[model samples]
Target: MQLDTIKSPGGSGSEELVPSRYAVRVGDIEVLVVSDGVLPLPTQMLGHNADPAVRSAWLKEMFLPQKAFDWALNAVLVRSGDKTILIDAGLGSDPDLHLPRAGQLINRLQATGIDLTSVTDVVLTHMHMDHVGGLLVEGVKDRLRPDLQIHVAAAEVKFWEAPDFSHTAMPPGFPDALRAAAKQFTKVYHNHLRQFDEEHEVAPGVVVRRTGGHTPGHSVVRVASGGEALTFAGDAVFAVGFEQPDWYNGFEHDPEEAARVRIRLLRELAGTGEMLVATHLPFPSVGHVAVDGDHFRWVPVFWDY
Candidate 1:
């Protein structure tokens, strides 16, 4: 059967065969998960600390490629009361990285009818390129409101000043690229930052709390209202995290602490049964956590058309 196609509203003349955005409602707050495309990275990055044999076995069990696979990149748009909050800007554009497909957040947002100026605030989970690069995209800053507030953890802002990569196990060029992006982002937008100590509410029922594992200032945002809740877990959790909570993702600045943070967050979500959405999970990455023996389980919610 031939696939149907929709023209992107961004007027790039590009066509998408599948939807790139999904919306979920938590009480009165509106959350829209937008796909920023995908990043195909080496499988070793999944768990640099894991035994290669074990990691390969798990990959084979999941029917994924042994070498590398696409990791979904997601960013969220939220509307609470009169405030419009953006969570993570997505990888904007880095031709040197040769990741042509991963920086589509800006175009995708435009296609969704979301104006940059309309975004009253941007809540960053961390300063990773994928999380803040979109704002650095040419014309992005100019399009945003001059008074726009960018909320991020004070610790996170401080860490990038002299970031360390001693514990991380990433691809050769990653460290330098990450440093350059973080530094450039801070330099360009320092005046707009609204640094918080630990937790800050960007809007009613929308709170960002630092978790301090993925990075010294990494954070997660929770949207809670009317007894319903959902958390955008940033880099704290990944698809493999539920099954291998102790494994260390290469992108984590503090792999050991990142593992602990993942375990703690997973356990908490499993107990609370709140919905979970993450940056690297599959598109629409809206799911619930379930306890599975000694580990945990990912229970993706049924698609709500």
Candidate 2:
């Protein structure tokens, strides 16, 4: 399938489904954007401290839809030589999410002619439900590729595995199902899991950096090959958070620390012109971050087949 073509439920020209796959070549590495699906988020979920009036006005000025915001659930597939690395498993095959249209990562991969059995490594940016939920399918773990090496931060494993894990610090309206899903993840993948700290290289060209805030072990994956580079920027920043580095995400466990890490890393990435693939940007979430005075903005790469 071409990168620009969207294959969904109803054939072509149907609005029910958006393009779920995009491909870009960064030097010697091939990056594929695999989308599970889009989720409808309430605009009120944005955690900016602006007054109601100011927030409403800002949304109007941006010409955003009055109701809900659309957040794309994206996963990055990095093919470097012989290694096939998947960053952030999407909403898996479970139909329980009942989300309008989600849990399509494995199907989308098959549609794109990518073999699931060939995926050698699975690196999770954090333990968010959307990122780690796909680790298991229908309550069964490692079903996709049992031998796959699953990598995550040591702190994240510790947080999720604690017997008395608490959600007190999580944002309002956070779903308890996520905690259950994470517990299952820890139980099933414990044997295949590899925990790493900062600057640990997982693949030939991929390195993990500690950029916590969203979660204790939240981190970003940096891929460099043939003098070109890109980053899988986990959940460090989202749509408006790009422009307002101080804005906290409702899902953040440590809002203060999340802001600190987001601002600090964004400044460096923006200054360096490093390409980044956001987990929750629009489809084909790859983009470049530009420093806009005291804040930053996302400049999406032009679409190409």
Candidate 3:
């Protein structure tokens, strides 16, 4: 796929496909934010119940492009103690996934001067292809080491592996093939895969919080140290969801419950002042959420120098 010269509607850039990475320190641990790539999704297809006029008006008010919104595939790399942890593996380097503008994760990681083999853990936010695709390089068997343990929510794994689960509807943005491939990928790494239930700490200062609704087992990673905390909001919040936390997305496995979880999470984040590290927000997806009367506002973090 060819790179376009389109400016970002998400306020992150003036050009498409500019590689980005940002780093933040939480006490002694370092959380590095990197992009797999950007996904341009049509605005109309997002908020299923939102009136077109209202959606358009919201975009206009925010100065966002009316046609499509650029969603970044942001993943976090955490270095703590002696372990090197990756929050979400990105859309791997593959063209067939139809993510024409994405799949730059491997190169981005290499650019950071971090060895692939040094990666001790990979914690998946969910089963979505864009989030888990970088777990392996396409057709490269030796790229990832055998000791790298893959962590996922047990409920998420069970839902996907169920016999009839795929027969049902999936989130709008997810392709059936991609979901099937994700399941197959887990099967291949069954021995190395570790599934957890509820909230638990998998690494020092790194904990996984079960925030379902987006997916059956969708969850977020919370990294806290000292008095500072950062939560990888996962798909709990995205795009218009920032302004309309109650507005459900077409990609939600359970729309109603998703909205509830989103609103609940937003309120908690706003009250506690925990930095929200979103996966689909603009690039360098680190920011804070503020409660604005009946709604919420996303305040992107200042670029760390």
Candidate 1, 130: how far from true, in Å? 0.5
Candidate 2 minimal-lDDT segment of 10 residues? 163-172
TM-score of each: 0.96, 0.88, 0.88
Encode model 3's per-residue lDDT on 1-305: one tens digit a residue: 00122122233232335546777888777888888788777776457678888988988997888887777788888877877888887877555546666777776666555667878888888887777777656643377778888888898888776523332244353566566657867867788888888887878899988888888789999999988999998888886786777666756777788899999999999999989988888878788999898999889887755
lDDT of 1 at 65: 98
Error of 2 at 171 (Å): 7.8
Q: Where is model 1 poorest over a 10-residue stretch in terms of lDDT? A: 1-10
lDDT tens digits, residue span 46-106, model 1: 9998999999999999899999999999999988998989999999998889999899989
Model 1: CA > 4 A from native: 1-12
- Angstrom error of the Cα, residue 213, model 3: value is 0.7
Q: In TM-score terms, which candidate is top?
A: 1
In order, candidate lDDTs are 0.92, 0.75, 0.76
Candidates 1 and 3 compared by lDDT, better number: 1
Q: Who is ahead in lDDT, 2 or 3?
A: 3
RMSD of each: 3.7, 3.4, 6.1
